[model samples]
Structure formats: structure tokens, C-alpha cells
Target: MERLYQGIVRFRESDYQSHKDLFKELGQSQSPHTLFIGCSDSRVVPNLITQTLPGELFVIRNVANIVPPYRDTNDYVATLSAIEYAVKALNVENIVVCGHSNCGGCNALFAPEETLNAVPHVKKWLEISHGVKEKILREYPDADAQKREWMTEQMNVVQQMKNLLSYPYIKERYQEGKLSILGWYYIIETGEVFSYNKESMEFELVTDTFTP
Candidate 1:
């Protein structure tokens, strides 16, 4: 806690002061170009990874970067509300769902519920990706444990992209070419990022191709 306070002081004295004008402009209003949805992993810092400053990307981080299908009920209201506001109000041109390597939420998908006994709410939240687990088991029955985990992480990103489409406003904007939904896989060990190609149905390195 003291460390955080010290960091705040340093920011006020340095980074914030250096970017005062930009922050001042942002104080009035923000017009971010992208809505970045990423995992809650401490290792995955969206702004740091993307090298984006404040007001550039509106970010939402959650366990495994999961996005539940649009529902009429109030469940998952925080995430749902952010998605709606980003699309309908902010009119963000791009929505990126980024999943990272070795995600605990993705690993939890294969673990027995009892393994998550201490985090019951987390267990419940992970159920949103149950279909991803089922699809992997059905299609890649012979895959090894490491392979399964990697596949689950990548597939979850694609699944969330589909979930984003369930929102009417997002769908309308997407169909009109006003919005683009992207899936990204980030490898933490190597600092490499892969973007999903809808045409090839494969995740290619961002350095190799520019789909978004």
C-alpha cells in the first residue's frame, strides 16, 4: 500500500506532470478509439503491452477475458454495462479480446470444481467458457495437457468475440463496418502477440500480418 502511494507521488511529480497537457485535455472528455478486453492476469498489462497512453484505449479486464453472451438479466452487469457504453456511447471503432498464455481461468476449465472451492464465484464465472472446454474435448480428444491448455486459451478469445456479437448495438455497428472485433493471443514468455485471422481461421503473428 505504501508502495502504491509512493508511486502516486512519483506519477504526480513526473509522468503526470510531463503529460499534463494531455491529461488536461482528457479531463474534459475522452474519445478512445478502441475497447480492449483482456484477462485479469497481473502479467497482462493492456496499456503497457500495447504501448498506449491514457485516453487511447478503454480497457476492461476480467478472469480469462471471458465475455458472456448478451442476456436480459442483470447477471455480469459490470462487464455488460461497460461493453454497451463503449460501443453505443463511446462508439469505439475496435474491440479487441486478448487472451494470454498460461491463463489460470483457462486452466480452471479443466480442473474439477472442488479445486476452485476457495473461489466459488470464480468457478461460477468460468462456466461461461464451458462450451470452449467441451469443443476442445470433442475435437481434440488426443491432445496432450499442454496442447489442450494452449488451445483453450486461444479458443476462449474467439469465443468471447462471438459473445460480443450477441449485443445488438455491437452487431449493428459491426455489420455497418463501424466496428471491428479482433481476437489476440499474447505469449508472455516471449512478448509476442498473435492476431486471429477471420479469413484463415488461424492466429498469425501480429508482426507477420496486419488484419486489424
Candidate 2:
């Protein structure tokens, strides 16, 4: 806790001071251009990875970076509510679904039911992406653990991108070319990011000169 407080002090003295005007302007209103949906992993820092400053990206993070298919319900839906506000209210032009290598949520999908039972809520939340494991098994029943892990991470990103389209506003904007949806797979240790290509159905390396 002290470490976090010290970090805040450092930010207030250094990074915050340097960006004082930007912060001041952001205090009144924010018009972020993208909605970045990423995992709740400590290592997956969306702003740091994207090199985006304040008021540029609205982020929503959760276990596995899951995006449940659009639904009408009276229940409390935190992730869905955030998506709605970012799109309908904030009018973000882009939405990114980022998944990373060696994701614990991905690993959790393959865990035995007995193991998952211990974390009931997490188990229920991950059910949204359970089809990812089924698809991998159906295609490569003999795939080893390493192969399965990477595949799960990448496939989960694409699955969430599809799930995002299930939202009526997002789908309309997407078809009208008013909105862009991207699926990214990040390799933590190597600091590499791969963006999915809808045309080729592959994840290609994102380089300095890369054009999406």
C-alpha cells in the first residue's frame, strides 16, 4: 500500500506536473477516440502498451477481456454498461479487443470442473468464451499445451470482437464504416503485438510502418 502511495506521489510530482494542462483540460470533459477492452492482468497495461495519453482511450478490462453478446436484461452488467456509454455517449470511433500470451483466464478454460468450482463467479464469467476451447479441440485434438495456450489467447480476442458486433449500435457503425474493430495479441516477454487481419484470417506482426 505504501508503495502505491509513493508511486502516486511520484506521479503527482513528475508525470502529473509535466502534463498539468492536459489533465486540467481532461477534468472538464473527455472525448476519447477508442474503447480498449483488455484483460485484467497486472502486466497488461493498456495505456502503457498503446503509448496513449489521458483522454485518448476509454478502457474496459475484465477477466479474459470478455465481451458478452448483447442482451436486454434488468441485471447489473458492468462491462456491457461501459461499452454502451463509450459508444452511445462518448462516440468512440474504434474498439480494440486485446488478448495476451499465457493468459490465466485462457488457462482457466481448460481446468477441471472441480478446480473451477472453487471460483464459481470466475467460472461463470469465463463461460462466455468456453466455445474457444471447444473450437480448438475440434480442430486440433492432439495439440500440445503450448500450442493450445497461444491459440486460446488469439482466438479469445477474435471471439470478443465478434461479440462486440452483437451490439446493435456497434454493428450499425461497423457496417457503415464509422467504427473500426481490432483484435490484438500481445507477447509480453518479447514486447510484440500482432493485429488480426480480417481478409487473410491471420494475425500479422504490427510494425512501425504497418498499416491496418
TM-score of each: 0.96, 0.99
- Tens digits of per-residue lDDT for model 2, 49-70: 9999999999999999999999
What lDDT score goes with residue 139 in model 1?
Answer: 99
Question: Local error of candidate 2 at 159, Å?
Answer: 0.8
Task: Give me the candidate number with maximum TM-score.
Answer: 2
Displacement of residue 103 (Cα, Å) in model 1 is: 0.2
| CA lDDT scores, all candidates in order | 0.93, 0.96
* Candidate 1 residue-pair clash tally: 0
